[model samples]
Target: MATTVRRTSITLPAARLGPENPLPALRTPADPHQVDERERVRFPPGMARRIGYAPLRSLLPVRRLDGYDRHRTPTDLEAIVIENDRLRATVLPGLGGRVYSLVHKSTGRELLYRNPVVQPANFGLANAWFSGGIEWNIGATGHTTLSCAPVHAARVPAPDGGEMLRLWEWERLRDLPFQVDLWLPEAAEFLLVGVRIRNPHQRAAPVYWWSGIAVPESPDTRVIAPADEAWHFGHERSLRRVPVPEWQGADRTYPLRGERAADYFYEVPDAARKWITALDGEGHGLVQTSTDLLRGRKLFLWGNGPAGQRWQRWLTEPGTDGYIEIQAGLARTQLEHIRLEATSELCWLEAYGPLAADPAAVHGTDWTAARDAVSRGLEAALPRSDVERAYQAWLGCADTEPKEILATGSGWGALEVLHGRFDLPGTPFDEATLGEEQRPWVELLHNGRLPQGPLSTPPGPTLVAPHWRDLLETAPADALAEYHLGVAQWHAGDRAQAVRSWERSLKTAESCWVMRCLAVADVESGHPKRAAERYLRAFELAAEDPGQAHAVLAGLAREAVPALLAAARAGDAGALLGALPVSVRERGRFRLMGAQVLLAQGEVREARAVFDAGFEVDDLGEGEETLSDTWFAIAERLVAGAGPVTESIRRRARAEHPLPDAYNFGL
Candidate 1:
């Protein structure tokens, strides 16, 4: 099941060559660049120059000391060495196992890599080469070069070198300032890529581009994004509904695993379609066009081999590494599409260039201006009224079903326990029906959502994920009570009773495990701030022995930081400052938050002070003050003259509505 991989070559006038036309002669491997309605590959006369546009020109291996840059080092192509200081770090996990070199340049940490283990002296499995340079190759006898570039393209070693399975190294000599170009040989091809990198900063930094090719293992690959949100996917594997930590630079792949290969794309805001999976089958494939840049249009090329070879061993690799992908959209652009909020400092074009009629150079409007237009459209669409109406509509729905009830299980117990929580008119449980040991925790469940953080020590009775507590005969029975009770109360909207029932189950015995359930309840009830405070108290209680204060505080802080920042971004004062510690008033994670508030209130000088202080520090660590802290302080300074001081009132808000469901709830 092998087909020869070939690339098309083109000729251009030397006078036309300049900063643009980085690789003028480079063309599609299939010798065609046009796709008809049916998406068959087409090789139009002007397709080569059409692919060569402004944005593509922008990506002509531009070198900049501060920003993105490419380095080409002319080395003895005969022998290649990629090594780092660490012993075990020499090899990346997935590759047939290619040893890499360690450099202290970016992350200041030593890691392994295979610079570019391509195939054929001019072609790469991971990279594609296109240029008008010297020729070279390493055949059975040894290495040889003709009119190609003076390079020794390293080839991936084959366990058994069959004529169809030869490995070649394609080298782009850095010293020569040569260019190597690679494009989808097929009119539409899926490109899957895997990149494992080490961030050099002691403080976390953003990886400007999450650019990887999406390749399809099978033919039936599809791409999808949320209809509402402006962005495609935020940080973490989950979508940002209420906002959580690391929401700023999230470009993670969704969780999807199975024997079948399905390539699917999801929007950032909607948790449903975050993944672009490829199903394991033959002759089935998909393609789509993005309104973004770099990726002219996505191509899903699959079933390249014999039928029933859809789930080939190579296609089984997890993530985009196994599936084909291209860069057209990212977190920021995806977000800007759905919401009319403040603009994010992001530019996808900077990484993959821009989309244009020409594949060889950059084209279309400049990304910054294009982003501005999108913002205008978003602003027009996302009025305050629209958001409010959506919120209202979302809140009015109360279709409690068996499946949903089960899913909202807090990862605990059975149906009977869930039913008990409902004291409906027709169906009722008598006092005698109540279990003695479970009554206490059940009562707590009736109290409402538990505080955020671990609800109890030693991890409360493992009612959820029952396998963990399978040894205890009582666990199943107790779980049944909890599950039924939860469902009943939840259906009736009697949150108090339901919360109390769940809580009482934990209090059955004085074991420390009950805290987590309580914490879950708190966050679920739209009271994370309250949960944070209660967690603090619970921590104090548990601290007498094996206090998890540090761990709990750290977790809460990590979770709260991003949410608070988002609230700040959205200008929700109460949501921002309420139930929060004064220690965090204008400090740490909330530093920028506080500054935004001040700036909004017309506190110029004071705001400047905040920014000034913030600029001084580089990193924001746990409980440590940095520039972010300074920003909050500045906001505080600006607000010093306004508003009456009020102590944070810790009032219990009734669970009238369901807590905002997580985007990727289970994940």
Candidate 2:
């Protein structure tokens, strides 16, 4: 299986930035003094001081601020290059192990945007980010905390037939390990990127991956994909029935212009291979494709305008032009959160390279014609059958089985009861065959929860409360029905009834959802002790269902904040920490809060311990807008006052351990 392997080194005269650099002097303002009035209003009291701020210095042509800069004199920077007959790839092990450059030998064109300079900007959660190349972002979000840190890299034989440049790193934010292998088969036009991500912890945690591919942007640049809808920013749903590329009043299929805005769109996949291509007028372009393993395809563009152009210049060198990013992810969309099961591993394959065809033939909104053109372009580079076979082998479809019908007693069946239709030909019972006692359950199963297609707005509890109540009365033994009744009751302003229903449901089946409902009721009823206990129980149940568990944990964390603060004020840091569920306590922010409280109480040792433990998990709290500053403040304080820590420990705690600022200011 091993193919020809060769490795070589190249030296690039890169700018070395420091106090002597031509760029404005870099400043690390004291944590307490770095505050923004706008952010002060949003963060909790004292939190503003802890999170610190990045001052906006120069702001006209290029904004100079606190973060990594690349404006110093030339220095010999070594880079590793791996290549085949058709393509060559270079990796910078020192700079986040990113693919610094990729070129198609035939055209002598860079497959990815090669930023001539290592210009770092104040756009990431960590306050520093470099543009261009393929940035493998994992853990918290944005470009990843490790985006600028060194990674473990080596050249090895690929599984098929070629050399692969392997890069890996342990993500401390979530305690997960991530790795990517870059392969270029001999005579093949495409480069294969195989990714492996694993959850090494004993419990599940939220995780995400975004592979950002930067390419040349121009007026004739167009995005081609087979999709009928796209999730705007991966949150707002946008439906386009006609051109599909048209959004609101603008056509996103063409190059962006005359706007100071940015757009994040994920195409709705319709085939096994989900893909998006950014092609120029000459038909020379970069196409990114993945199998079902990678579920999301995204297109990002910074419009052409004063502000947009300014931002573009800030992140790249003068001669290097602005570029658009074609990204792919392992989730439904960029903002759609996903959790990895305990000790589970996720693997997927993605390919990217040059594509050539007639611009006239490929430029359009018709997906069929556009796809054919792309296929033709790819075939011209390599054997179509060989490419197909390689892709299929990487996908490993032979071992997968067709999905079977769900068993009636499974937990997922409860969801089916809410949405499944019982009028199908294979139904076990008909209207006449059903007995009087089964009528209610049958009706509940057959009645759809919501109409087909996207909902304009969420349904009010009153709309479905009565139906759930009726189903609960008839199916007293069905825990799922009782749980649904509880949800309906809670939303209908019947807290007492909701608690009772949830308790009853727990007697039949112990579920995190029911526990979470009880916890919410207790919190509202001024029973923090009871609420804390319920939250703990719910955390234990999360191992069975990560999605539901994570949802419940989020709610619990928000509701428990006041109670934890109260306990801390009572001079009981242990009690406050213990009251938090395992999931909540494992997060970086919550642990930081606890440590700060202990430090204020003069429990220096306990505070240090708490701070050390916080570094173990990557906790991307509720939102970036609120927690980014808080996290930075906590890190700054830990470095300043985590008593007697070694130099190595301090460096690791500050740089490698803390969550990067990239997550806060997304790409």
Candidate 3:
């Protein structure tokens, strides 16, 4: 259905493209006859006769493609276009519902970087990521695994007085449902994007969302946002702090040729209205504003050097120029994954439009002045009240039972009222409705009284174990129940039983939490090799942001540190090497431990090499001075040997702790 209101039109049409050729499946080279039957089991019952155990593999021989391929030029494709008097926006509903293009009517300027071709790149965890357009990334890291997939889309009447284009999908990983509604009022110049995400399951899970907006990269382009500091990506999955736009005495807003890649996550100031802009020197660009619900802004760009230029060609076509991403996330930054409570819903409003302003005013540091100027200009072009009304209408159209707005009918006003009323609280388990045998265990899990780690009180676990055991016996297929049973058993000093419970839990369902528990149990049981493998598997399953992944791996590494250090001290270098988790190179503490162990064993050359593998700059935050002392000691000891301290080592040390006397210490 298509609708026209005043000078605007919303149309959904199907167009023909060409023949589809899907990418080939990725397969391991191992032969089927070489597979071990024991490894083939999803989860083995217990430790068996075989001293060595191989990991399990999927039974299916082939994998499916991410989604249907409609990018082929001659094939039939479905598209939705929303147009106003001054702006036109095109969306590819069948292609992940991506906003394919947005153009300003007056100047005929393309506000978005529209790829000349629908090219897919192997960049996401699912090995299929499409370049160009605005992609709604939800769930795990990178462009969502479903970025190349289709979504359910429809055109519906706006409650106030316009038309809305709605797209929704049930994510594959956790069955989390997400819906997005795009509205363009007849009199408004901006496009309103409303989002709703729901967790239907009864168990809590990590949820992440980022709206990725791609724009053409130019030498004079600048990313403007109201932020002072940013979390800059550093070595070893660490985050170093620097000023926004300019970091370490270098201007990063627009990179010159051969400059390093710029990936920054900024924490937006908490305000009623926050905005980020990406504009060229011509004073033509896009502005994205959101209420308090969306609080993060990010700027990512592939540098204009040969490497990045090559990557640009790889991600798209040869003639396609490099681009930058202006992203808005629901959390403080994209690196911080938000935990969505069980059976709860989250909703937010975001708006995007073409804005024309003086280049100097747009890039000014006085955010208040710049914001006031932009807001006034926007109001004059299209009244703010009309945008608010469009948002209210969108909420009514999207939700069957719309939330009542008690404040002044403005968008931000409604958000303030909703925020105060609900607080977006998590749903806790209701013990009154639980069965008798399940009540105690459910209470233990739900209530925050129980201690979770080594510092936890003893009586809590002692009191909760029997109830968890009872639930496990009655509900053998419940993965979470089995997992909690293992936790209780572990806390009660029943190590062997805990491992068995965890194995059973894995058999019920392959969860990263279960894998981590099993890994910890393996380390405690004096099986470091198995523990390392389990940790690797858990890391793979995590598929999280770099910060979260680093934190998780750091915890697991700390748990296995005792075993690793013991093996290294015993001069069992092979065991020590095997005990290190996969990607140990990406961890600062692991590198430090490896170097210290090698030094203790009198392997001066190896110690120097290990020490040369510098620690993460941001990982050693307040303890940097302490680590600097340790580094000086190590360097002094190494200098006494045949190998001399290299300039790279001194440079790295100075980069972390820039004290004047850092390298002037006597050997």
Candidate 4:
């Protein structure tokens, strides 16, 4: 039978992706995780261009989705299945177009690690993501924002005459339109994927694309890539190139051999074939290969460390095998971004299939022979010429209109297309897809004035893109317009003008949003006390708006109470905490914050009760240390008797008051 595409499903226990926080995330990570100045000079020649680009300043237009918690129930996910005689690929269309499972029909082998549960964690850029399957990482340095979000999915004409599943989205962080087309040819062993990223704008934009594949890991599993050296990054602040396969007397190829979690960005030769594989001791497993344009390949190991093991266990069910990542990207390393010129495109073809090589050479001490064996196996399984041919064939029909539409994603893409007059040939963001979120901006774009909800209503999302900023700047000086204009200005790095704009908005009418914006500015200006006062005012304003969503109020409280505690206004913090409904206050995060507020007020006994009563932050981030830090602070306060908190006192407190396992979320 010819290749066929059909609707499918997978039901698993998944956490509730709670409502998005209705607050603008106006901050970005300030730390620079780059190679040391001395080490920079030693990097490969002409690598600076890729190493530096415009890192994001704020996720303004995309609100924070931190409200999700760890609650699980059986969930049914709609999927798309594309199968030929040899292989079957099931894609979760709603879940970032993730390739949920790829099984070889002949051998009955599952090529990818299929998780038993769809547990949401804080790994994604939007703060809610689950491990397993294959994820397409775009946007900035970390996981793509669409990790848990849906994308436009449709059925398009495949190169082999059968239909292919197409997934497209307008990536907002970089303002680029991209498409991923998956097709399995009749009787073919490999699943072919053609990806295209189009920059329809008039200026150059930084582009980042990485296809991440999670493969099952075992003690005998070894990841093979055609590279003699690699760029190694660890928990420590350093990125240095080291010998591949064997580093520091140990074979780094095995995922479980290391002591700590790390990423090894392989330095594949320009002339070498770009491919990576994770094979068992028998040298049979999955292999991912792509065209030369997709140059970078990497191996991410969770390693054998306690925190790493804990993280592994946390992502899946109680009894499940651990997994490692074999990824392919555009640049030599993910820390870098390849620049795509205006109105240009970055397109490539990738193939996933089963590979079998000589186990003796693959697992042997000789790295060159080992990689060579896998490379040859890839050439035999699916040659570079065949991949190029497939790319060309796909390009011929890339713009073929979808014969049928299956699913729809965010309306942001449609809004951008309408506003910018963008013509994406292969990927269409139809006007029919526009929804409520785009309604306000659409009105503002058509009419010259920005729309404002009632004063009793909380401020909604902000559109801080450059185009929206220009539009807002020219529109009448409405208070709401000015507030959003300030956010846009701040996003563009014009701090002084932003502050002035906020001041102007405040003069027109004081708003919680404006106050919060000013508070962030105040903190940046080294006035934490004034910032605290502004946050308190914003929290009070939040209280009066009963129409505000519960998530929004909790988000405001989360932001405000921390600022109050930072300013040592423990009484105000307690009052703000008390103002919340008991249901919201009893959540793990708020309870932890309650303990911090109590400790700040020297009420150690009351704070201890918070930790004594069991609680868990379901959405705890991968490396966040807030829970342990709060517990240690309370422990220190328990022993601090009208004395300055010293290192010795801290050590003694930690030694005597061991952090309870329930509350210890340290990484």
Instruction: Report model 4's TM-score to 2 decimal places.
Output: 0.96
TM-scores for all candidates: the values are: 0.27, 0.51, 0.54, 0.96
Tell me, by lDDT, which candidate is best.
Answer: 4
Off by over 4 Å in 4: 30-39, 639-641, 658-667
TM-score of 1: 0.27
How high is the CA lDDT of each candidate model?
0.26, 0.55, 0.56, 0.86
In each prediction, how many residue pairs overlap at the backbone (N, C-alpha, C within less than 3 A)? 153, 11, 7, 0
- Cα lDDT tens digits, model 3, 466-555, are 433554445434566566667656654576887898798788777556777787777667778777667656645543433333334444
Q: List the residue pairs that clash in candidate 4.
A: none
Native RMSD of candidate 3 (Å): 16.8
- The alpha-carbon lDDT assigned to residue 149 of candidate 3 equals 62
Task: Pick the TM-score winner.
Answer: 4
Model 1 residue 222 CA deviation (Å) reads: 24
Candidate 3 error regions (>4 Å): 1-76, 234-236, 255-258, 363-389, 400-667
Expressed as tens digits, the lDDT of each residue in 1-667 for candidate 2 is 2233344455543443221111111122112113235644554343343233212221111112222234444555546676777778777766666788888887899878787777655444343567788888775445565655656555554656445666665554454566676677766678887777766455776677888888888888887765656644321222122335666687766657426444445555545456777888888888877656676777777776554554576566566677888888876455433668886778777777887877777776565677678766765654435545665664442122212211111122122223333221111212332343333444555552222211111111111324345554454345666665666566445768877877887888786667766876776688777776776666456534533433344444444454445434434434545555675565555565566566556566666565444352222211233334444445545666656556665565568445542323322
Off by over 4 Å in 1: 1-325, 328-474, 477-501, 510-513, 523-533, 547-549, 556-633, 636-667
